[model samples]
Target: MVQEGLERLMDRIVLAYSGGLDTSVAIPWLAEKYGAEIVTVTMDLGQGKELDDARERALALGAVRAHVLDLRNEFARDFVLPALQAGAVYEQRYPLATALGRPLIARHLVEIARLENASVVAHGCGTEKGNDAIRIDLAVRALNPDLEVLEPLGVWDVTKQEKVAFAKKRGIPVPAGADSPYTTDVNLWGRSIEYGVLDDPWLEPPDDVYVLTRAPKDAPDLPAYVEIEFERGVPVAINGVTLSLVELISSLETIAGVHGVGRIDLLENRLGDTKSREIYEAPAGVLLHAAHNELQKYVTPRDLARLASEVGVRYADLVYNGDWYSHTREAMDALVAKVQERVTGAIRLKLFKGDHRVVGRTSPFGLYDQDRIAQSADTRPSLELRP
Candidate 1:
């Protein structure tokens, strides 16, 4: 105990702060536990302008300094675009939005830790059963193994009620909706809701839990049609109007959400062979994936197409299992990029009542030979086989 206390006096910790109770409480707890000075890093990864207040909250909670970086553009270009082009949907369903965001956050956490010369970096992934802990830890270790990765919540091992009580006792301003049963994570790529009644896999997700998408039954009576254009596997336009990647995705999220597309409910296989009941709203991800996938069929040859699909599944697994910075993922990305060379095209999709389907596709590199494929039998040459 004497030696442990001595080590605490020299500690400086950098924490990933979200304007939430878990993180807010972590500030005081980490300082008290390690007798350390706290430096907080809050990232704006399409969460919104509200994250600005997180810095103030961190300071109020006894953090020595706070850094908030706007990483939305980098996230779209460096993370979302590559995952989309690679077709990285974990378990053939989730777009891996939450999973994708973790590594980027972890990368920055290490950067901030290095800048502060902190001995330890921490995050608020509270549950032992969840995957974010593994994701953040792996990314941190991969980037800079010398720094200690701290998970205060993991060590605290307290229930949500306990956490709330602890926050209140410490005079931490718990965010509004702190008592809400459902826990959610939101970003540009998607929004995920879990816990509360959602823990019952047999129960339907309450309508209140969803934000980005409307209920399928509540969607409009008339069907909607959209044209999405891609350049080398990246979505570049919507309905013939060119836009920035962020703008394109945001627009599609609204459009597809209005039509009640991209609501996913699944039993996700987390790391360590555990399972989780998860609900996700990813209007833009679903639409873009549908369009990009259909366009690939039109442009990619059969053998290469098959190979790309296989690589995509592996890529998805790697992302889900928290191997984002692995050399294997880099190699797979090279192949995915090679396959996407000809995936330049436009795909027309019909959307109605939570359903989206590809209606048509056109591409300069399309391999479909209409004359040969659509020819009648009489117009085609007959071949005879020897007996």
Candidate 2:
């Protein structure tokens, strides 16, 4: 059924597809609602083999064309690394993995829309009840306000099961794991799980919700230690071996996941002025932020360090709220960049069952001077004479 005013208004639409159920259903739905030709874009941001047949799936769902982009390297170097340097952690728990990916994805949506001569851009974000839909909307408008944006689920008012039925009725194949009540978003930086049983804030997340980490009880009995080296606040090496930014993060995720080191369950404040229970697994992000902060503190002065901490919170908020392209965010990035100039060093961490702490840090710019220390044993003589 075509919506009254929207029918025929959109001649062509470019959709940001995730190869998930929501997006699979969207290809046919968008075509029906607006009588438009639909082109789907699926981005690869280190989800491994999960995206193997995304293009084929999109084409089978009646898409005029399908685009599968490999954006992992760009995602890491351009999006993830800057947030790592800025120390952008939402509410000190979330590393904003999904948040950081939204802008980059939206940017490409606009580019694809222009190439396709699309009058509108669409997304499978589903609803405005959560953060992502708004993030997509704002980012697209920011990049190109002239392009109309559409969200099918915002108006569809259907349950997940209903969506499954809708897809089946149209001969669109339901994605694996569609029957599961939980909703998940995955990227290089983290994996976020929510909805269904997770909406109950009091209920502990089931073990099935986690894929990147082991249960704390099941982790190795012996503690594992890792040495991370940072150059200008970006992690460049692991245990004395240099790696690309993407490789470094992937290596840390494996090492830290084995120790069950990065699992966060929090009651998060959504941008819609509502609170919701969210679970996130970001092993690499956790380790890197801790290690980077340790080395940063070793070299940074008190006032500058404090300022970075304050700016970091705001930076996190802006990114989470979908203001990634704002001039204010750019200004904050400049401040963070200056802070990073002195943040080069190495951090050694102890990773024990679901816990990680920085046990050692060293930097060429470190301010501490051991020989000039005024210890209890040696400092009394000079002070007593003055008194």
Candidate 3:
């Protein structure tokens, strides 16, 4: 049975497809229910060879066309770098990796929709109970109101198991099941794990939830030292060797991961109106943010540092809440860019078991006054009755 209003409202529908269980079902479901031709877009933000398979799957699952765009550089330079510059962390924990990526994906969805002359954009965002639906929907509305956004699973009464069943019944291929009991999303910046037993805050996340790191105990016996170079707050090199944005981050991930540098567990406050236990593996992002923060302390004034911290939190909130296209976010970006002008330098970091700290920092623009603070002419071993 055709859905009542969809027939008139949508002709061709462009979908932000992931080739996951929900989105695999969406290709057929949208066609059957809305009689709309489906165009699928999958972004490659350094998720590796899976995208080639995903594109193939999207077409096999009944998409009229599938586009797989490599957006790694743009994602890093435009979205990820700005987050790093502001030291953006949601709730002071999450590096906003997943949050930051959604807006860029949403923008691409609109672009595909326009090129395809589609009247509607759709996502397989599973439930209204998650932040992704709100983020993707708000971005679509903000960027292109002419295109109606659809969440097929939000209205459909299908459970996860049923969706899997539907895929099997419909002859759509599904990835083999794993014993690992977590839902995961990975990109160049980090990996985020949620769902399954992770919903319980009291239970410690199983070691399998982590993808980019070893357990601190299992890390190498020796500590690893890394030096990151920054130009205006964006990381550009590792140990003085220049690299592209993506390569720089990837190198840090390996160097930091060897010593167990990034692992975070939080009972995060979600935009969906609940607190959720989320685990993140952000070796590169964590190390870069730490390096950037330490370097900024050398060059940034106290008052500006305090204010930038405040701006970072607000920036995190906006990015997390799907307000990335808003004027307020643009204004905040301007402030962050100004603050980053003098944040050019290098930071040496010592990475050990589950912890890392800045061991040294240097910058031509540094505000540290070593001669006065460390070796003053009038310094004395003991002061008598100064008070």
**Where does candidate 2 stray beyond 4 Å?**
1-5, 374-387
Give candidate 3 regions above 4 Å deviation.
1-9, 177-180, 377-387
Per-residue alpha-carbon lDDT of candidate 3 for residues 40-70, written as tens digits (9 for 90 to 100): 9999987644676777888888899999999
Instruction: Output the worst ten-in-a-row residue range by lDDT, candidate 3.
Output: 1-10
Give the alpha carbon lDDT tens digit for every residue of 211-309 in model 2. 999999999999999999988888889999999998998999999999999999989888867887899999999999898877888898899998988
Question: How much RMSD separates candidate 2 from the native structure?
Answer: 2.8
- List lDDT for all candidates, in order: 0.87, 0.88, 0.84
lDDT of 1 by residue, 116-145 (tens): 988688899866436888899889999988
Better of 1 and 2 by TM-score: 2
Q: Give me candidate 1's TM-score against the actual structure.
A: 0.94
lDDT of 3 at 351: 89
**Which residue ranges in model 1 land beyond 4 Å of their true spot?**
1-7, 374-387
RMSD in Å for model 1: 3.4
Each prediction's TM-score against the native? 0.94, 0.95, 0.94
